[model samples]
Target chain A: MSIKTSILSSIGQKLLLATSGLIMFLLFLIPHMGGNVLFLFGPDMFNSYAHHLHQLVPIVIGIELLMLTSISVHMIMAFRVVLANRKAADKRHTLKSSKERSLAARLMPVSGIMIFIFIVKHLLDFKFYEKAKTTLHGVETYDVYAMVLSRFQGDPVHLVFYVLFMVAVGFHLSHALQSSIQTYGIYVPREGSKIKLISAVVGWGMAATFAIIPIFAFIK
Target chain B: MSKQINLTLKVWRQNRGEEGKFETYEAKNIDTDASFLEMLDVVNDELTLKGIEPIAFEHDCREGICGCCGSTVNGKTHGSHERTTLCQLHMRHFEDGQNVVIEPFRATAFPVIKDLIVDRSGLDEIIAEGGYVSVKTGNAPEASTTPIKKEMAEAAMDAAECIGCGACVAACPNGSAMLFTSAKVSQYALLPQGHPERAQRVKNMVAKMDELGFGNCSNEYECAVSCPKGIDVKNIARLNREFIKANLGKN
Candidate 1:
């Protein structure tokens, strides 16, 4: 009856999660993907892109807050749904077998938690870290691109971590995309296969594109 | 008529609202062509002759149309066969000297009445919330009165195939009835007759489902897989959409 109670219902919570997740993907992930492409174009272009982003301080801060809010909402709803689902089935099955569910679907919560950790670490290392000294003509410049390059190229551990996180992203997105579509009730029976295929393609594409940047940074 | 087989059945036995356990029973010389329920009948006959308590289960049509008879066989709701109810599952699917595990549908809402018989009246209560269209009592309208699209009618029929068996809840690890709820919602949501009450129908049904202790669908899709009617998980999505539309007053 009330708006809050209506949204807090099991299905309502899921819808909220799906809707927020899609918005996060569009607002944060797509732009992040586009920006990561700059890594391939050498340090100058990448640094300039980073600088341009910094130039729009107010807008950037607003977008960052919005992204944070989206992630927080998505995560809270997910946790509630998980708790409700657990409570609903208090008795665990002795023999567990799920043949129809996709691996990505099964691994959603696990991958989600991992992705949360990765996002926090990523922000701390790249966004929050400030003192990167690059000396050009005996003058030190706070170099964003140089910082990224050093983090990826200098540390094999960081590279591996980045790649692993991308894989987790792939797992989450593969299920999330089609799930979001379904949650929004956009399914046509005839296009079911196509929807699944597209979700897979987009998920893997985003992951691969993001993952390739760290690999290219190390190798090149 | 196939060769007869003997099966060691591990059937769940419990009294009303009490702790239950698996009670082993030997079903000997069972006809391979006989239905799974028929095999159970043979076992029950042996138990009765031995002055032991017979296994209690539910059945009506024995033709798969009635949703009454449902048991988890070897951790599979409605037996191991896809889209097949327990009454329709033949004994030929099993091997000689096999160990078959039969249990009642487990869910908070569907408490076991006794043995394999569970009180699935929770499903009926969910239906009663809003599973129908209101119509005045009168002569039936002409068949061609409302022109529905071929695809829409087919999709609606696909959803309407749900027999209201608690297989979806039983098969689900989370015991979610989203599949059943979605199927019922979609059946009417797809038809024009169901239009007037579409918003209210989904809202009430979903509310009752959650209120009755059915789990939220985590997209595990086990419900869809174990459903006797082969109901699509897409219906769950449609239910989500309908719920959103209803809440937003768009419907």
Candidate 2:
């Protein structure tokens, strides 16, 4: 099979999905979570961190393009693989039960769709939202800290929504992290796997870090 | 004397190309020592005397090696015993008043022919694809000539132990045959004799598997858990690597 034909194959499509997902996990989500942690240190640190990120315009644009491509491929392959799987399993038994499929694995597509919606809402709430200039460290910059505080401060609904979607993130990452390894042809033992531990830790840990922003902003 | 139990069986019943439904029957005087199939035999005998149609299911080797018999009992493929086939499951496992729900191994690829007997010709087709070696290495050579490593041989044998049963498909939520195909792929891929056709074999078999309306694996591990032979998903990981190597023009 050539590259094109293999890309069209079922396993090949899965390989593509795993690759794109890992790229986003490594490049995008990790850095985003890292930046989010600065929110805990106070307004200047957090706002400055956000402001300096705009200095790397070319690099950010390149990363954005890469992310755009990755997300598109991920969604497309997910659509095809899921639809094909459904078609193959059309005549399901009424009494079927799965003992080995984890809730995280079972809820992948659900969390995926939820996470997609969350990303759109998140970008609109922060990325695409207007950022007014403020004097910080004797330099004019976007007051992203104030923006976040104003959005979630005393707004229980928005705060809860942000925190709730993190669980969806947790669900997706917990499964995708280990699943990508298996798809790449690495054997993760069914029991006592360190990879499983790391997956859960990183998945929920990142979610917790992201969730803390809205929580602190809501309370403070 | 072994204990006898009376039970109710809700069995799926259907003819070829007909809509199916579950029919409940009382199985009285089931001996605990009897294998699940023998219990079914007793039920069939009773039904025959009563002029009712005997519930149709498949069985050849009552000991579980032939891969000729399988059915989902209460939603678990081959009942709830770990690594035990339906034929190997005994009546003693059931409670005295248990309600057993029996059904065919369901999959779009393995369509039910009648009652619990599904047409597993799809598996046969997958085997025919590349499950054999054709190097023309004439009459059986001495076993000592091959020089197979101990661990490698054991792993190959492990992969070779799969009986082509469709339990993996039935257990998979997506009706995937990945476990079955991976076992075949791993057995050959691990041995020296099968190296000559390695690249093409994985390619052909996977294509056939996908072409036959089997679902893609979702990394759920259900197929691994449901296999009566205790076939691990390690073979599946190897298969994914083998498929990549074969399809990536690495040959």
Q: Deviation in angstroms for B243 in model 1?
A: 1.7
Output the number of the DockQ-best candidate.
2
Tens-digit per-residue lDDT, B1-251, candidate 2? 58999999999999999999999999999999999999999999999999999988999877788898999898899898888989899888899999999989988898889989999999999889999988766798887998989899999999988998799998888888999999999999999988989999998888888889898888988988889999998999999999989887674
- Per-structure clash totals for the candidates: 0, 0
Give lDDT tens digits, candidate 1, residues B132-185: 989777998999999999999999999999999989998787789999999999
Per-residue lDDT of model 1, residues A36-111, tens digit only: 8997897667766776776789998898899888999999999988777777776644435666677898788899
Worst 10 residues of 1 chain B by lDDT: B216-225
Docking class of 2: medium
Q: How many backbone clashes does candidate 1 have?
A: 0
Q: What C-alpha root-mean-square deviation, in Å, does candidate 1 show against the real structure?
A: 2.3
Sorted into a CAPRI-style docking class, model 1 comes out as: medium
Candidate 2, RMSD to the unseen true structure: 1.3
- Residue A24, model 1: Cα distance from true site in angstroms: 1.3
